[model samples]
Target: MVARRNWAGNVHYAARRFHEPTSVDELRRLVAGSDRLRAAGTGHSFNRFGDTTGDLVSLAGLPPDVTLDRDRSTVTVPAALRYGDLATALHAQGHALANLASLPHISVAGAVATGTHGSGVRNGNLASAVAALELVTADGDLLTLDRDADGDMFAGAVVSLGALGVVTRVTLDVAPAFTLCQYVRLGLAREALDEALDSAYSVSIFTDWRTPLLREVWVKQHAELPPPPAGWLGTTAAETPRHPVAGLSPEHCTPQLGPPGPWHERLPHFRLGFIPSSGDELQSEYHVPRAAGADALAALDEVAHLIAPVLQVCELRAVAADRLWLSPNHGRDSLAIHFTWVGDAAAVTPVVAAVEERLAPFSPRPHWGKVFGLAPAAVAAAWPRYADFLALMVRLDPSGTFRTDLLDRYFPRP
Candidate 1:
């Protein structure tokens, strides 16, 4: 037995043992022997979603087997492979993913499991790229689900929260390689951002919530298109590159200033080898339907005083809707409000609660892997397909082998 903590060091996993299997056969054996277990990837999750009392398994030791199907325009990747590494390899082969999150350090399976996303009105969350997956169930049996063969069930399985089983491999759709350029605008007014939100391929607006204007706006545009508008909402285009969080060296960030680069290099904010975001930070995010965005931000502004002292910065982005049952953007186009806090959980919890309460009227859906203060009842009420997801969980893991305190606490089984 050994002790392990999550990437943020905020969650100390309480597993009786930790296992890293080098092969699917070995992984199956571990799953079959444990009555209660959970799988984690790269420890990127901030909370206890990947913790368990019985055993915690990771597939990092397993060989990364990446294959491309030319006829299908898809690539099959090992669950443990991080997006940065996978993107590099795919780029070498003249292929690319649709979008990437702000950081490229997270595991593919872990990110999809928790509904991690990138910013784009036309782009879906990472899970939406999944075309198929292979997982080991409670009985140690391996099952594969393809989007073509299993429709609705596949939607639920992509954002499974590690409840159904340990995901082993994922098949994702790809497109011909492309190039993009990033441009930064300083201090854009709220109305200006609204007008240009859908003007670019991807847009990210950063703020501290203390002012009516946003601090920075990063717009990623296709190399083939014209540049973004200048002098928007009292904000002007930046001649030099800048980090998402003010004062941080732009060297650590991806290339900017309209220089065309490979899609993988320009899509994310931080470069692959550099540290991503403020290292000493806690993250919390909520997704509300796009129509409620204005009201939601207004509500958060009402509590800006409560949020600022504990916050590093806040980011706003939009995500396209998908059919995934548990996805925050499930059924409605979403506006995501994210916070990077000052790393003091005690000082941040109250603020998190206050934000949740203020946005309750919008029925915001919390990010599964991030810090949240929603009560169990509130959580259960947010997802319209919660009951269907619960039923699916039962069918996949009848013995509750993958259940954890995190799941049981918020979504208790009957």
Candidate 2:
């Protein structure tokens, strides 16, 4: 059999067998019979979190089962469905999700499980929108957990990293469809970062760290708001389209230049039809308290010389706090500093470690789906509810059927 690799082609799965079950019954049977298994979603994660030595299952073969409850303001979808497809379905019905990650191509289950997010000071990470989810556990039993009914355990489960079981379905909060306009500004001063971030409904700052000035500032504002000023913070609006990563074609990016568009179209940085980001790249992100945003940038600046060489681009965005135990933005309103590095792991690995070391003072929590060199203990210490999540994992998956080497490292079996 051929090898299976993730979307970035950085990590290869070690599963002895791969299974695609067309029905929940078939998926249950596969889970019950296997000594060990791990569910693979769109394979967008860059790490080994989805790797296993036993069986690997993909839920893409199952029915999408998209259902919207206008009364409850929620939408239920199959776990494997991409956010882009789900957004299209929701928008068609005159509804929309509160927020989406930069790349809408990710699977709902994977994105939620790993605490993926989009840019906005008031927006919570994607997992914060989960209202309920259904999963098949080690015993082949279908279990459903609701945000309101399950309380703390549900909070712990939302960003579970696939340790509890295979999430098959998810119900997310929705809102009336809305529209927004995207604006791109160039050459923002470093000191004006906070004001620029809060200047719009959703904002993204891009820089290569080679200069003191920010290279690009993408502002996404609600359509109802007045147009941005001709010149603010000494930054000029882009005369033409711009890519987050310098020099790349802007064709893949979502519409920009202050034209009003659907929330789904303007909220995400990339268009649904295009491959997100530069496809051949490795990503790493850390969330520090919003109050520490400036300090965090200064910390990263210390290592800018090392980072700029291997980096494609660096983005800084904000995310509101949420209750999800494993989420990087948990407890504290956060400033997410994201790095898009060249695909060469050998060269990029040390830079990642250096970045982590510089940001260690702020107790940064790394995005679970991305590349990071932080030690297991350091990572566990960053999450206050880490122990609670570990206990919840053991109670739900006693036999560890869903366990992977990555999970085992952070959450050791007693």
lDDT of 1 by residue, 1-414 (tens): 133887787888888889988999999999999999888787877888788889888788888889999899999999989999999999999999999999899999999999999999999999999999999999999999999999988988999999999999999999999999998888888876665568788899899987898888888999998777666567888988897777778897899889999999999998899767545779999999988888899888889999988988899999999999999989999999999998899999999999998999999999898999798888889898898999999999999999988898876786
The candidate scoring highest on TM-score is 2
Which model scores highest in lDDT? 2
Report, for every candidate in turn, its global Cα lDDT versus the true structure. Answer: 0.90, 0.92
TM-score of each: 0.98, 0.98
Runs with alpha carbons beyond 4 Å of true place in candidate 1: 1-3
lDDT of 2 by residue, 1-414 (tens): 223888888887888999989999999999999989999988888899889999999889998689999898999999999999999999999999989888889999999999999988889999999999999999999999998899988998999999999999999999999999999999999899989988888899999999999999999999999877888889998999998888889999999998899999998888989876545999999999999989989988899999999999999999999989999999999999999999899989999999999999999999999998798889889999999998998899999999988899988875
Instruction: Give the clash total for candidate 1.
Output: 0
